[model samples]
Target: MDPVSGELKLFLDREKIRDCLARLARGEDRRDAALIRASCWPDSTSDYGVFAGNFDEYLAWVVPGSPAIPVTQHVLGQSYFEFDGALDGDRACVETQVISYHRVDFSVEHRDTTIGGRYLDRFERRDGEWRIAARTMLYDWFQDSGVSVDWSQGVMGMPFSAPHFSGRAVGDHSESFFAKGKAR
Candidate 1:
């Protein structure tokens, strides 16, 4: 049987992990780069299979050229977390399954991509709060809308743009904020 202290720690750890996933989903949908950064430690490393970098680089990659389509939702499944005991130490390991939907707009078709992955995370209790210290992503499977675009034709005569282009609103991206502050 688990001690009262151990049970409480487990519960808190699970909740914190869940909250982290929720924050990540919200940040991705609203393009809140700061929120995403807050979810990780200052010098955390991420391994995304193809790309491996620190947390700051990960945020830059996310908010810069996101697909300009409808919002996305990240649904987290049952997670397994093991706390390494606060009395012993302040480290924990978590594994969560994430199912994400990416609403994308193509030249001829508008659809969403369903992607599933596993997030393996190392968490630390810092300043009485749980924060992700490291993360590694494993892509399990993905399904897309199966739409293809031709850059040569510019997709129904649209102007030459990026494959993920969906035309963002002014001031929605971070560039506008920087420009305004610089002009002040």
Candidate 2:
């Protein structure tokens, strides 16, 4: 019974941690600071080549409305975990793969930069919750290419519009997954 219970707890904790990562990715893609910050502890640390600092500082760097990159998409791959058997199994290390795409536009031309990398993270489960304590983003490879797309028009020449019931909004008001669940 002891082993079974411990395994169950570990499973649940892993799920929670993965959920946090997913939310963080969604937050970045959606430009939702609150959602992004919710995944880390109050005193978490982040290192993204360009900057290395606390979670609050990280938020200040990317949060206030729109992220520097106008459009971004983060694709989560797999996560590997190393557990530290402490009380309540509070400590863990997770390495995850992420493929990110950022759009760069200079009016005359449109380009997309793609980055393939891993997020090496240390997490601590506090108060029955798992949150990132320290994170380092390791870049493995990257590529940039030019592309053309009109946000205002779709392939069929119709307005590139998201369905109202789809819960895809321009802002947090409706486009959010949370909003979609609460909407209907």
Tens digits of per-residue lDDT, candidate 2, 48-109, equal: 99899998898887665333356677899999999996537689999999999877666767
Cα displacement (Å) at residue 79, model 2:
0.2
| lDDT score at residue 123, model 2, on the 0-100 scale | 90
**lDDT of candidate 1 over 1-184, digit per residue (tens):** 4688867766776787789877776666666787778788888888988778998787886775356564466788888877775644578888999987776776567676888998999988788777788989889999995653434466678776643343232234444545578954
Best by TM-score: 2
Among residues 3 or more apart in sequence or in different chains, the pairs in candidate 1 whose N, CA or C atoms overlap within 3 Å are none
Relative to the true structure, how large is the alpha-carbon lDDT of every model?
Answer: 0.72, 0.79
After superposing all C-alphas onto the true structure, candidate 2 shows an RMSD in angstroms of 3.3
Q: Which stretches of candidate 1 lie over 4 Å from their true place?
A: 68-70, 85-88, 146-184
Clashes of each: 0, 1
Report lDDT (Cα) of residue 66, candidate 1: 59
